[model samples]
Target: MTDVQELSDWAPDWLQAITPQNRAGLQVPDQVEDSRLQTPLSQLSQSNHDRDDELKPPKITNITVMPSPNRMVKRKLQGIHLFMITVNGTLGIGLYWRGGQILELAGPLAALLAFLLVGLLSWAVMQCITEMLCIWPIPGALSVYVSEFVDVELGIAVGIAYWFSYSVGFGALIATLAAEFDFWTGTSGDKGIDGGIVYLLIPVILIAVNALDIEIYGLLEVVTGCLKVACLLAIGGVLIAVNVGAGKQGYIGTQYWASPKVYDRDAANDWGTAFLMCLSVAIYAYMGVEIVAASALESAPSARWTRKTSDERESQLAQTPNDSLIGNTVRFSAKYISLLATISYSLSGLLVSFDIPWYHCHLPRLSWVDSTANIDCSDVSDSIPANTTSAIVAIAVESGIPHLADVVNVFLVFTCLSCASTNLYVASRVLFGLTSRLDGGKGQPWHLRLLSWFGRTNRYRVPLRAMIFSAASFIWVPFLQLQGGTSSSTSIGMFIEILAQMSSVAVVIVWTCQVLAFIRYYHCIKRHKNVLEQQKIPQLSRDNVEDYSYRSHAQPVLAYVALAGCLFVLVVANGAYLWKGFHKFPFLSSYLFIVVFVAMWILLKVARGARWRHVDLSNPDKVVRKLRKLHDIRLAAS
Candidate 1:
C-alpha cells in the first residue's frame, strides 16, 4: 500500500471538523508559532479551544451598528459552473484552427509531439499552482502569488503582461468565433459580426456577465465547459473511429512525414522563420494553462467534507475495538486515496491534450507562377495543406455520418461561442486589474489610466466601468476588419500571437515560482511532525513508492525537464527568431508593448501612494484572517 492510502486508513473520526459543513465558520489563526503548520489554515484559531468545548454566542455591545442591506448576493455556484469557467478559459479558438498551422511545420507526427510536450509541461505548471492554491487559496491566484513570493515589480510586470495578452487573445477569440459561425451558417453578411456585429457583442456580454454576481458567471462557464468538452471529445473519437471504419488508410500514422520536405531541416533555408512560426503555434497551445491557475478562487472553500467522510469511515472501522489502531490506519489511508482521486480527475484533463482539431493535406509541387495559374489552389497555398480546416472537419462529419452536419455545426458553434464568452469575461477581469483609476482621477488621458474604471462599484460589486473599457478595447478589431486584406489579417494574427507568446513567457516565470513554491510546500509536508503538534505523524510502513506525495517523484522530474525545455525554446528557438529579424516587425512591436506596459505598472505603483511599508509578509495565515473578517462582514450585512 502507499503512504497516502495508509494515512487515509489511519485518519481518525475526529478529523470531520475539517470538512465543508462548517467552511463558513472557518477562521485563520492570528499567528504561527513556528513555520511548519500542517493543519488547514481555516481550522486554526488564535485561542486554542478544547475538543469538547461548547460553542459560544457573540455578546451584543452598545455600539450603534446600523445594518446594511446585502450589497451583493452570494449565489452558490455548482461544481459544473466551476467546470465551465475552467474549460471555457482553457479550451478556445486555437483548438479548432491552430492545429493545421502546427501540422504545416512539423507534419502530423511533429504536431502530435508538440501537443504532448506542451501538455506535460502545462501539467507541471498546474501542479505548482495546485500547491500554492492549497496553501493560500485566494482569488486572483497569479497576482496574489506574484505579490507574495516575488518582488512587487515582477508581480506588476507579469500582471500587466498577462492582462494585455488576455485582452488581445480575447479579441482573437471573438474573431475566430465569428469565423466559426460564418463557416457553419454561411452567413458572413454584416450586422457587424465579421469584425462588425460579432466584435460588438463580445464586450456587451462580457459586461453583462461581470455585472452579475460572479457565481452566476461561474455556473454558466461550468455548463458551457461541459458542453464544449463533451463536443470535442465526441468529435475526436468519432473522427478517429470513422476513419478506421471507412477502411481507408484513415489513421495515416505519420504518412504526412513520409515526404522528406515535411521534416527535413535542409529544406528550410529560412530556418529562423520556420522555428519562430512553430514557437508561435506551440505558445498558442500553452496559453490556456494559466486559466487553471486563475480558477483556484472557485474551488470549494474547505476540505471539511473530505474530513467528515474520512472520520465516518474511520469510526466504522473502529467498531472492532480490538482492531482499533490497525483498522483506523487502513481507513485513514483510504480517505487520503479518495481525496487524491478527486484531484486526479482534474489532473487527467490537464495532462491529456483534448485540443481543437484541424485539416491537413499536400498539394502537387508548383512554382509561384504555376500557383497563380491554379488560382483554386489558394486555399492550400503556402507549400502545405490549406483547405478550410473547419469546413473540412464539418464535411468529414457530414460524409461519415449521414445528415450529421447539423449536429456537428451546432456543436462547433457552441464550442466557439462558449469559448469566446469565456475569453471575453477573463479579458474584462484582466482589464479591470490593469486599468488603474489613480492616475486618471475622474478622467485622465487614455495612456495614464489604470483600473480607475473598475474601482467604481456596482450593485453586485461588479466593475461596470471596467467592463465598458474592455468592450471599447474590442472595437480595434473592426478597424482591422475594415482594412479587409488577407495579409493584414495574417499580420494581425501574428501580432496577437507574439504578444500572447510573450505573456506565455511571463507565465513560465510564474510557473517557475509556483514549482519552487510547491517544492517548498512538500518540504514543509515532510516536516509534518513539527507542523502538527495535535496529531502524531503517520508512519510510512509500505514499500510502494506511488503512495507518497507523487510530487516527491513526479514534481521534481517535471520541474527540471520543464525548466530545461522552456530555456531552450526561449533562448534558442525564440532568441534565434529575434536575432535573425525574420518576423522582427511584429516581434519587436510585441516586446515594446510589454516593456511600455510594465513601465506603466511600475509608474502607477509610485502614483498610487504605495510604499515599502505596506509590503508586509505576514504569511498566508494573516491574509486568510483578513479575508475571513471580510467574509464575516459580508455575512453580517446579508
Candidate 2:
C-alpha cells in the first residue's frame, strides 16, 4: 500500500479516487486519522472560507442600517452633482425678482451691506455643517446632528420647520412659474388664461423629474446650473456695459446712489428698520446654499465600499481621518459659492440701482383685490413690497433691448421650474429623514406608523410617496389664485411673496439651530480633550482639532457670530407687525412658521415625555473617540 505522505506528493484527484476505492483497507493507517482529528476547527473553517470567499463578490455597506429607506438609496451623486444641486437651489427666482425690490426698500449701500453680512453668517453655518458631515455623512443630516447634539424635541421641530419651508417654497415657485407663463402670453386682466392650469402642470413636471433615478435628476441639475451661472454672468456683463454707456440711456454711473431721497426710510418709517428688513430678503437668496451638506450621503467617497475586512476599514479610516469626498467638495463649494453669490448679489444691486432709480422700480401692493397696483414709493409709502417684475428683465427693457428682455423672461421661467424641482427634492428627503427615525417599533403611535410609510422607497429607490406628498404643496397656488375671484397674475404673485416671507423666517430659525448645535459639538470635543489630558493619554494634535478635511475659521467665535446674526434677523424681520398694527396678511406670513415650530416642539415633547435632563450629548462625543481609537490603532499597525 502507498504511504499517505507518498499519496500527498501525487495529484489530489488521483488520491481522492484511490482513497474512496480503498477506504476500508486504507484506514489501517492510524497516523493519518489522528492528524485529521487534531486539526483545529478554526483553521479548517478559515481554509474553507478562503476557498468560498474567492468565488463571492465584494460586499457593499449601506449608508444606513438595515430596513432604513436611506439604505436603499444608491450613492450615485459625485462632487459635481453636489455642486450643481447647491447652485441650482441657491440661485433662483428670488435673485431675479426680489433683487430690485431689496434695492428699492434699502438703497444700494444698505442692500450691499445686508447681503455681505448674511453671506458671512451663511459661510459660518456651512463650516459647522461641513465639520459634522465629514465625520458622518448621512442624508438629511441637519436635523439628525441637531437632535444628537441638542435636544431631540428641538431637532424634531427644526426638521418639521425645514420641511415646511421647502414645501411652501416649492408652492411659491410654482406660483412664480404660472405667473411667468402669464408674462410670456401678456395676459393679466380678466381676459387672461386660467393660472390654475399652469399651477397643476408645474407640479406634474416636478413629480416626473423627481421620480427618475437620482443620477438623472443630478444630471438635469447640472444642465440647469450651468445655464443659470452663464445667465447671471451675462446679465452682470450686460449691466456693466449698460452702466458704461452701451445702451441708449448712456453712462448712468452711480447717479441713483448719489440721490438722498432714494435712501428714504421703508414701511417701518426708519432707515435702520428698513435695513433690518432687507436682511431677510438677503437670507432668502442664500437659503438653499446648505443643500450641499444635505447631499453628503450620496456624494461621500466610494473608498468606504471597497474595504475587504473590518480591520481594513478601520485602518484606512485612521490613515486618512479627514479624507471625505463630500467634505472636500462642500468646503470648496461653500467658500467659492458664498463669495460668488455675495458678489453677484451686491453687484446686481449696484448695477440695478444704476440702471433704474429706486423711485421708478414698481413695488406691488400685495392685496387680494388688485394686487398688481403699484405702491407709490416716491413718498416712501408705509407699505413697501416686492417688485411685480423681474429685475433682470426690467434692466434689459430699460436698456432699450426688448428682445433681451424676452430672453431674460424665458430664463426666469426656467429658473422657477428648476428651483421648484429642487424644493420638492429637499422637502421629500426631509420627510424621509423625519419618518426614518420612527423605526416601526412595537406600539408606535398610529400617526408615526402612517408617516413611516412615506419613509419607504419604490423600485428605483426614490421616495415616491414622500415626494408626492411634498408636491401637494402646489395645490396652494390654485387655491390662492381662485380665492375670491378669477385667477390673476397679481394674485399668483401675492401668493409667491407670502410664501417667501414664511420661508425666509424658517431659514433663519434653521440657521440658528445649526449654529447652536455646532457650539455644543465644539464643547463636546473640548471635554474629550480635557479627559485625555487628565489621563495622560497623548492629546489630540492641534491640526486634528482645527484643520480637518475642511477648516472652519475662528472656532467658537464664528459660530457665536452666526448664532447672534441669525437671532437678530429672526426677531427684526418679523418685528414689522409692532408698527404696522398687526395686519393679518403681513403678520401671519412673517410669523406663521415660527408659531408652527414652537407648537411642533411642544407637541413632540409632550408625546415623548422628554425632560431636559434626559437629553443625550454623549453619543456624538463617542463618535469622536471612536475615530481617535482608529487613528491610534493605525499608528500601532504601521
RMSD of each: 11.3, 12.4
Q: State the lDDT of candidate 2 residue by residue for 1-638, as single tens digits.
A: 33333221111111122332333421222121111111222332355556564344423211111233332455677777888888888888877766665676666676567777887878778777766665546556778667767887898888888888888888877666665665555434222344435666558877999999998988998998999899888888888877776444544557677853333333546666667666766788887877776566556453433536888876766644332433454555655666667777777766776766665545321243232233354533222123335666666665665477677778788788788888888888888767644544457668877877777678887888888998885556554654433232344455567776788788788888988888887776676665434322222322564234545679889899888878877777656434634555666767777887888888888888888553454653354443333232212111
Maximum-lDDT candidate: 2
Residue 163's lDDT within candidate 2 is 86
lDDT of 1 by residue, 379-427 (tens): 3324222323443253344344664545665676676667656655665
> After best superposition, candidate 1 residue 406: deviation in angstroms?
7.0
Q: Clash pairs of candidate 2?
A: none
Judge candidate 1 against the unseen true structure and give its global Cα lDDT, from 0 to 1.
Answer: 0.44
Poorest lDDT segment (10 consecutive residues) of candidate 2: 30-39
Best by TM-score: 2
The Cα RMSD in angstroms, rounded to one decimal, for candidate 1 relative to the true structure is 11.3
